[model samples]
Target: MKIIVIGATGRVGAQVVTKLASDKENEVFAGARTPENVPNASNVKAFKIDLHDTKDTILSELPDADALIFTAGSGGKDLLQVDLNGAVKVMIEAAKKGIDRFVMLSSRDSLTPDSFSGPNPSPLANYLIAKHFADLWLIKATNFDYTILQPTALTEKPGSGKVTLGSYSSNENSISNVAAVLAAIVQDDSTIGKIIEMSDGDMAVDDALKNLI
Candidate 1:
């Protein structure tokens, strides 16, 4: 399958690219704002994608792909630009391109802003607001299959190869587990059009996906 991964330089995006590229049957088109940060792989082709112009960027790179994986987002002041507006742009372009399936990497509760942590989540958490808006828009948009994976706080520890998949968000997921789940979903046909929330648990990734479906 031909798949395009946005934010290929990011923590979870990078790991997904690595796994996809290692598989001979999969072709990975990895995009990052900085080309140098995108990892090298025999099957992965890296390119620079400006989040500010996500529609054009994706239109230029994704026509040939069967799926698009959206992991791109900004945390600082640019979060609104890159996460909310940029995300909607990408999804819109994907619909125009007739892309078969699209996957989004989102934060836990991003779709339900009222459930956000703290009476005053930092301004930085505005990123979550943007993500929530994007997710809501996608839920209401037309064309193309979609999957939204909402995971809790990300960590850098090596993956435990375990996770819990459900419809509700929680604070228990690890970055490692999230990455593993993303990679698994990229290859799993059953997860299309589903919104899966992930958290750390003793269940294997395959088992998690199974239970999720």
Candidate 2:
């Protein structure tokens, strides 16, 4: 598989890119706004990409990719620009290019529509709303293979080398554990079209997803 990872410089995206690139079965394109921050992977090439660009940075960097994984997110200033519109831009480009597999790294807050209806949510909540819209757009945008991984309260917990995948639950997971889940989803064909919510668990990432429909 030829995979492209947006936000490859992020805390979790770095792990995902490195894991995929090390697999002999996959080749990786690591895209970041600052290429220097992207980790060096043996089978990966780094590219500088601004998701906020109108010209479609993802399209330009990964024109022939088989799978596109979006991990980029805007924290405070402009959630509408980076998370919503930026993600939409990539989805549009994916549809135009016929990319088959799309994986999105979303937040657990996206599972609840009321996340934005609270009494003046924090800036981070608004960011989650943007991510929610991105997931919705991808779901409605194409018939190609897709999966959304929603994780809660990310921690720095060392990936217990395991995870639990299902619908939105009250369970929480660490960033490393979530990274493990992303790695599994990218390599598994059976996980396509599933919105999987995950948490730290006793089963390995691959095993947790093995029985996932």
- TM-score, each model? 0.89, 0.90
**Model 2 TM-score (2 dp):** 0.90
How many clashes does each candidate structure show, in the order listed? 0, 0
Q: Candidate 1's residue-wise lDDT over 36-102, tens digit each?
A: 8887988888877787875766678654688889888675558778888888888887787777788
Reference-based TM-score, model 1? 0.89
What tens-digit string does per-residue lDDT give for candidate 2 at 1-213?
888888889888898888887787788888888989888867888888887776555576655788888888765567898889988888888777888889999977685777777787644677777887888888986776999998877777676776767753436677777777887787788889888877777777777788676
Worst 10 residues of 1 by lDDT: 167-176
For candidate 1, what's the RMSD? 2.4
Local distance difference test, each candidate: 0.79, 0.80
